[model samples]
Target: MQQWQRQKKASPKSQLKVTFLGEAGVDTGALRKEFLTEMLSEIERKLFVCNGDGKGKNPVYCLNSLDQKYFRIAGEIMSVSLAHGGPPPSFLREWCFQYLCSGDADHLQVCTSDVLDMEMSLLIAKVNDATEDSITDLTDEIINCGYTGVVSLEKKDRIVRAIVLHYTMRVLPMLDQLRKGLQLYDLLVLMEKYPDICLPLFVPVHSDDRVNSTFIMENCKTLFSEKGSVRRRQECG
Candidate 1:
């Protein structure tokens, strides 16, 4: 029985949790450094990391892209994330090849050239008034400037369900509109539909509300009121 148990322990059905080194508690600089450290830690498990600037650009963690055969050669997978900021920094790109993916031939990376902060709903919204030229320009902006990406995000939310009522009078696009409702929440929910994108780059922001919101994302202000922001929030709820 003992031997059987030991064998079972070594079975392929084992899972492990790893800290990808993001902001320890809300300190932006510390978060970057922490994540950098995790990137340097043990290289035995599969890693998925999200890279974003404190807010505007994608923060990135890559092994290598220079030598395209990294995945073919490296044993461990290193998934790079860019789900938040517009474009991840170039240094991260350079370093992916120079360090993570090169000398340590044990790692590989996954990359997609998309701004970390795109929403399907928002994209749909842009279709009405935006031209094809505008869309292409937007994509280019996202890739080139980095966080400087020209994301064509206009009225990101819509009350489609409410509009489809029997007695509900259909309203024209520009003619009828709700005042500032769930602008950021809708955007985030839309972004979250892409799990592949959010995994590696899940950075927690600070807020006084019980629920998190982009409107009050104070990455640096974890504890604003003496009442203890997060704690007080929980207590009140």
Candidate 2:
């Protein structure tokens, strides 16, 4: 890790500049497609690990402590974005929200209900099958190994969601801010040092004739519209 950090520090810096386009020049169709593609890819990657057959090592487990922190931060950012009327990232909607909550219910109620019971039961079965142990024994071992406690499934879901929400909220805005021309190397350094902003520090933002500053900014504004006090109170509380 130290060696990698030193190498990163010595790396050359790059910058990503984002600009907005005027209405006359904007192609809403192309922009929408690009946005959907990026979001879908991100969601699919996250869910693949959770739903994959027990075979090769899980990338989620392979992450170092710092990387894990960043991952959770990213999750939290997505959660807050959803709460503020931003579109819920596909992964959060499918994996965390769907399993943890029911339609029109609070997160707490969702966690405590039977929403995830079937999924958890299947997951437990898979674990026991792989480990050659009884379900109860494997569950106990899982708790003892410090992954999570033997609490009710809902409680466990609530805890996981809390961690996810925290990280996601912090990471997304930071990524958005990077469009203001932060050096790629500096961004990498920040992520490395903080270990809580899960974005890749070197994402390239290309601007062609078709996609300009107005388009980018307008899309962002539309997606992340400011929610006033009433919405904030309802969502946050």
Candidate 3:
């Protein structure tokens, strides 16, 4: 175990900016297919991939290649650096951010959403996933990052409305938790919505149990500090 840890440095993959996009020889389950479909269509995906290995480090585990592929299907994957020294000879690299291979700036936009953010044109792609276009993923990247204003800006339209009904079903009930209130009271009220988005956190795999949802603060009322996390004092001398 120690040997593996020493060797397994968590930097970018040394090879071809290679993203393992869902391997398959045709045997993938329905749930995985559904997830894949959603993932492929999702516009906000960053590169924080969940491997099928199913260790305790992620919110969801890719049980099969299908799950992994489903995640990549939503957005196009690009290779940021072609050679070890730098990018390609062209002004644009083969791939830029948004996980896309195309470097064209004027292509028609597509509506993409994760299982979580389907309705809103808004997305919170991970910091690691931040390329030229930054996606504000709902993970720690949202609260801790120095961004307090709107992260996503798209006028609502057809593309943003595909899963409107489904998103409504999950969002309406869960929004009450975002209202200002005591944390414990909020937890008590929210605990009733178990297994839903309103629940603290729910993931298909057991590994997600450690990903604490309570830390997703909807506001930045406290002042900033250098030492990480703020002190909420009414007045200080």
Q: How do the predictions measure up, each by TM-score?
A: 0.17, 0.27, 0.16
Window of ten residues with lowest summed lDDT in model 2: 196-205
Candidate 2 lDDT, tens digit per residue, 1-237? 132234344322312111235534454444534443444356336522333322211113223433434343343333323222233233322222321222212332222122222334354444534532344444553453344544444344433444333333333332332222232323222333332222211111122324222333344322222577676666655
Judging by TM-score against the true structure, name the best candidate: 2
lDDT per model, in order? 0.28, 0.33, 0.28
Residues 6-105 of candidate 3 have per-residue lDDT tens digits of 4336432343222235844433344434433333223122313323333211112223422334222211111112112221111111111211222222
Q: Ten residues in a row with the worst lDDT in model 3?
A: 87-96
Which regions of candidate 3 fall more than 4 Å away from where they truly are? Answer: 1-166, 178-182, 185-205, 208-237
Could you tell which candidate, 1 or 3, scores higher by TM-score?
Answer: 1
Query: For model 1, what is the alpha-carbon lDDT of residue 126?
Result: 46
Winner on TM-score between 1 and 2 is 2
Off by over 4 Å in 2: 1-29, 32-36, 47-62, 65-88, 93-95, 98-123, 126-237
Q: Give the TM-score of candidate 1.
A: 0.17
Candidate No. with top lDDT: 2
